[model samples]
Target: MSPPVTAPAGRKKTLSHPKKANNMPRQPRTFKAFIVLCAIALSSPFTTPATQNAQAQQNRAVQNQMQNDPDTGSKKGWWSGLPREKKMLYTTTASAAAIAVWGLATWDYGSSSGFHTAHEGAFEENAKYGGADKMGHYFATYAISDMLTGLYKSYGYDTRKANNYGVLSAWAVQAFMEIGDATSESQGFSWEDTMMNTLGALTSILMARYPALDDKIDLRVEYIANVRIGGIFDDYSNQFYSIVLKLDGFDFIKNNFLKYLELSAGYYTRGYDTDEVKKRRSVFAGVSFNLSRFFYQKHYNKTGKVLEYLQLPYTVLKGSRDLD
Candidate 1:
């Protein structure tokens, strides 16, 4: 059946010409349906590519804000210089303690029996199994600690200063060992050891340099475990354990047991070797003891807490328990 067609609004109702009467153009059903569909598509709220991109950008901006916010991580307070006299006193004490402990422990191993047994086997074993080939594990560890402690004192614990203290420490260690190589007739240094020490120092320095960025960066703990592993050999073991015990104070043994336990946990956890044993061994082998130094500084001095207590000046405790 044919449908009746309507004429244009301004056209006459009937066409007089034969050509116009039968063959006049008419809209197809397909074309009419397409026009209706197009109108519906245009009216929809579905976003275009540009709008989607804008929305994606907004999401990324939100994520960035959450990541960069200071609240997401801790920050150090303004610079507080360590008093010169105090710094000198602490440095002298720390150096003396370190030297005494190293000497006493190494000698206790019976390596000091006229020929230096402590240096022979331990040094050999460290050279073979340890990541670097030159210096023995103990020597390396001592050197690293000494260098880093010097860095801490040099900066006076100022967090405001750029934190390349680690790198500075590492370089110092390298330089000192190399100088030892040149100067010491009995204990000549090896280039291999020097290079390895450099590598290890770089890792510590870089980590310390970008502490904020490196906070969550986890490495295999076993790499530093060499410090504890020395315990397997009785002489070295006693020395380390005794030092830690003494640091807690002989009088306060009971009170400091928990602290000692925590130190042990740190030593073990960081030293446990898995896949990271190889990589971290080279990087962290000599520097593990520095962790102990860090602990001593933070806890022993209680610098932050001391500053806070000083700032209050006891006024806030006017009616407090201490006053009572």
Candidate 2:
């Protein structure tokens, strides 16, 4: 018989729709660079001396107004400022755009394979150290909720109520992302991931609402690098997680020099899904600066405040044990 014909090289041929596989449902490799660029761009507007003075003056004016007006001091009510109609319109438009963007990004974009689905519960088992990627989701949601909590507080919302708003906002974003994941052929929706996200967000909101826990504890993430073929956040392997407890939160150390110190406990896992190295988990106990209680006046120190929230660049000391 004559030789059977085959599709030409360097091209994909299909009569029906192409299978939406091979495109990983994860952040782009350039994500870190993208975040750095975004930070620089966002802060550039306040760089010039004139702009600085203007901003400082504006902050002072707002502070003065808040100080003077008993009703408008600090935060406004949930119903304050923008009209509800405009808020709804903006929200609807943003949600639509987000869905569209997700579709474009995930429907096997730039993938080398076709769409394929797995048997139920097939991908869920032994899903790489309990889907450590879920930690990424948790941290992301927590950070967003924390930011929104601060913003809502700055806008003068009642503290507890503002925290609720932050939680809801984080939950909404998580829902959108999770829905996208559920639809992807290359990946399945993970309940573990969702629960971790809730746990992360709850910590942020609860701290915002109670204030006492905020005074005592700090949840922080540290990363190095992770590389797995099908891993979420595969580019970074050592995403160390930590919770710091301020000694000053207790009366015994509140008046002593120890007030400036904090004790942190952290966990990290490495080498998952790799044949060259064994999967390892590490437990960490460390010390970090407890600068949250530090007071500043006469300046709107946005940069310092942000730095205080982050562990800062290169200033942590730790001891660890590998739990093989």
lDDT of 1: 0.28
Top candidate by TM-score: 2
Off by over 4 Å in 2: 1-81, 84-96, 99-103, 106-126, 129-131, 154-156, 225-234, 254-256, 273-275, 291-300
- Residue pairs in collision within model 1: 111-117, 111-118, 221-270, 221-271, 222-271, 222-272, 222-273, 225-271
lDDT of candidate 1 over 1-324, digit per residue (tens):
000000000000111221122353211111121222223223322222224466457647855865888553234332323453454446345534543353234212122124210121212323222221222222232223323333343334432231244234334534443332233222233344445456544544554455443232222112111343322221111111001111222334465433333111111111211233532221111111223324335553222111110111111111111100
The reply for model 1, stretches above 4 Å from the true place, is: 1-93, 100-127, 130-156, 160-162, 166-187, 211-213, 223-324
How well does candidate 2 score on lDDT at residue 95? 44
Total clashes in model 2, counting residue pairs 3 or more apart in sequence or in different chains: 10
Q: Which predicted model would earn the best lDDT?
A: 2
Score residue 294 of candidate 1 by CA lDDT.
Answer: 40
Summed backbone clashes in each candidate are: 8, 10
TM-score of each: 0.29, 0.65
